[model samples]
Target: MPDTKPALSKVSVMQDLLKVVAPYRWRIAAAVVLLISAKISTVLVPLLLKRIIDALSQPQTLKALPIYLLAGYALLRFSSTLFNELRDLVFSRVTQRTVANYAQMTFEHLHLLGARFHAKRRMGGLLPDIDRGTAGIAFLLGVGLFTLVPTLIEIALVLGIITSRYQAWYAGFIMLTFLVYTGFTVVFTARRTIHQRRVNRLDSSAKSRLADSLINYDTVKYFTNETVEAQRFEEIMRHWTEAAVANQKALFTLHVGQSAIIACGVAAVMLQAGSDVMAGRMTVGDLVLINAYVLQVCLPLNALGFVYREARDAWVNAERLFDILHERPEMEESRGMPALSPGRGEVVFEHVSFSYEPSRPILRDVSFRIAPGATLAVVGGSGSGKSTLARLLLKLYAPAEGRILVDGQDIARVSATSVRSMIGVVPQDTVLFNDTIGYNIAYGRVGASQEETVGAAKAAHIHELITTLPGQYDTEVGERGVTLSGGERQRIAVARAVLKNPPILIFDEATSALDSASEHAIQQELNRLSHNRTVLMIAHRLSTVVDADEIIVLEQGRVIERGSHEELLGKHGAYARLWQLQQREDMDQRAAASRA
Candidate 1:
């Protein structure tokens, strides 16, 4: 689960939205003009109806029909729809552009965030948050601007007509009805927002669970835990279903309450209008007018209620998105900082100290220097911080205590991107994109020609194997390159490094997971790759580091020994003990194979 930050307030969310919409303010103004025109036209429809009715009701009016008034009535209705359509057309660009801008910002921000941030987040949950947030922005902009504003304008126009042409009491009664209905809607929707948030949380949880299970599909199959995975997924879905039902119930209650209030208000207004007509205080046309106005006002009140509720939900969703934008990237790239100056890849780690958490230190006062084109290997057991050294050099993390100098420039003073561009890394596990082999190789250097790509592949000795495949270099590598054998994937990684041709390279346990034959083959390629490049090799097996220019033995975050393999073996210290143990294990394995 990713760390959850406090959500932005509704006002803050609106302010952010305003900034996104600022570029298209002229279009928004045009839409507003169209909106006002539409509402004015809509208000005139009832007025026209009242006039037509009064004309027909007159006894002498049978000979001269009110053709002009009838035509105007139809025109007003058509004009209202036309204006609304134009308003949407004018505003569509702003809405879509705003969504696109925010979506791209959030996407880029996620990439800018640190490794720790990603390590703590589940992609399944993060993706849904972004999707809902963008959608929420669109909904709020559309409904808040067009639906809510238009409804308010229509209400005001209808109320002004009622007050001017009829008794003050009628306007007062309608106003009171609106106030009560709005008050009820606000209170109920606020409570329902709680339910909506819960539903959203559970929905994210279910998605995260599904993604996690599927990502480890082979692990589950090997452990025969299909039932266990299914049961866990069902548990999350069961909670989601309950939350969804509760949300629906809240919606139903809100809608029914709104309808009941409108029904009572309409009934009372009609009853009073009927009484006034019977007493001859008001004509039939006036009675018809009040009825039409009341229905028109009340109907949009229902829509207003819906739009208000949706706006609240949209605010909730948008807040989640804004939370991502609010997250400060761990390494803030300062403006005007120079990129790393190109040099002979001289790397120096000076008394570096670091800890992911304060209490659990991974490195302490570690110091080393690798001159250009020299290979330095750090050999250690599983928790010994060899990998952390590589990470520090790459600028994935900044050392808590000393500074790292690459080409005599403090990496902290230069662009992290530039530092990374100068180095090529072949991690222990090579996780490729789910793309064609050619595409994956081309990722090493953007815009590399086919000849260059093939040359690099051939240099890594994987080109012949790739050519034998049915689709050749175009063959699709499944998710994370799982379709390829470990050796094949390692070769692809080497190919990528070869294509990059960086001045410095880091091989972090590159052959640690392979069988003896595969390890021997890949080791040769790795040695070839290391030629004429500054190399940092982090290895678990002592045998692999014998040929390194210098071998450092790490034990619990400290360098226990440093020497050439011959010097360390002559000394008969920790390095010698590890070498003898590995040699015995290798001989035993060979003997067992011979016996078999």
Candidate 2:
């Protein structure tokens, strides 16, 4: 099925725009006053020129030359320019503030959105929409407000003057020309919209492909598929090229048709005015005034046609961005929800059950507890719901059937930010921001001091390694910490968590990415960091959990064994079997190492 949504109504888009402009209403009002004054001066300039031309044509009027009229005409032209510039100067603030406000709102809302939404969305697609949306807001505020509104005002004044002073035929012909020009523009611009929309879609897709391909540059090089990736991108670009050409052709047709209508209207008005002058019913100045009005009114219509076309695409882009703002987070809390205040870091999963979908349950009636300042290890096979427990505790996903509590308070009643703020986590694959080593570590605590950051690094046993580097703590960790080895990145993750110093901590296979030597070395640091903290250890390497206070072996979302290492080993059940298997694997690894 094609993914299509109805575009927002024009009234809704305008209302949203007005809301952004609400704070700057006074400035906007002032700008409008200046705009009207400017147009008045502009319209009167043509009248003054007409008087000057008339005076020049008559020998008696030319003797004095009416110096005041010429001076007034020049002054009016200058005032028009001056008022227009002043209007822009006042209204530019509204445009800038409105765009900045919307952009910031969008930024905050994107972060408020759920993990599922972000996981499904492409960064490349959202970025261009955001950029275009802000640009659209600027255009709507600046050009749409100034150009479209002023043009309509000028046209109305011209039509009213003609209806009041000239023959009915002149007014009738101008109205008819306007209707024809407008109808042609509306119909042609609507057709052009189809091509513009296609161009926009292809442009977004091409950006997405470019970003995706570059992010996976290593994978592409490994598979030697650079040519294939380039070919795919070229295909998207080719489609965009064809759509752009079609859009330009439609624009040309629209402009040419509008110009023809205006020309016919101008010719009809001029011919009638000339006939009146020849009949001695009107002066030569009357003909000149009529011609000037036609040019003034019709010239702005050309700009109107262009603005109308561009505004359609801008409207579409802005609507798409506003759609993102409308997306409600999956786990948004109530407005007055209380923050989580953990006294002892006591975590309890009471009959907890969860699933991404109804039929695919990841955890079923699973329950566990960790006493204050105690360590509970969860050992499980892949897809056995170990990580889901950590995510649930983090409030990234809520349990479908039961409640999770911290310090006897149901987490559902507290804010997710507060819940997250009270706990620290180190996941299996640590993805660092492309920043300095010190910056990535300090991210764990928002306002940690430099000394505290270094202390955390030392606690994580990475300080010595960092000191050996050329830039030390200031060295740049390239995208996702690609410049650092897996062990180094994992250590940095540990340093971050250590810096946070949360009462509740979860090590979700924290050492899984490390080799035997690195794991053994970092294990000491992990042990030290877990001291006096309530910890949940989810691991596949059973050897690391041997000294854990309690071990729960999970399989298919069910806990099959729970006991200490020796006690579970004595049972000869799931824990024993896994332990024996890992024991043999470890021995084989050691034997292979010895031979090498």
Model 2 ranges with Cα > 4 A deviation: 1-13
Give each model a TM-score.
0.97, 0.96
lDDT of 2: 0.89
Give the least accurate 10-residue stretch of model 2, judged by summed lDDT.
1-10
Model 1 poorest 10 in a row by lDDT: 1-10
Note the clash tally of each candidate: 0, 0
- RMSD in Å for all candidates: 2.4, 2.3
Candidate achieving the largest lDDT: 1
**Candidate 2 at 85: error in angstroms?**
1.1
Task: Report the alpha-carbon TM-score of model 1 versus the true structure.
Answer: 0.97
Residue range 486-540, candidate 2, lDDT tens digits: 9999899899999998999999998887899999987887898899999999999
lDDT (0-100) at residue 311 of candidate 2? Answer: 86
Q: What C-alpha lDDT does candidate 1 achieve relative to the native structure?
A: 0.91
Alpha carbon lDDT at 421, candidate 1: 97
Q: lDDT at 425 for candidate 2?
A: 92
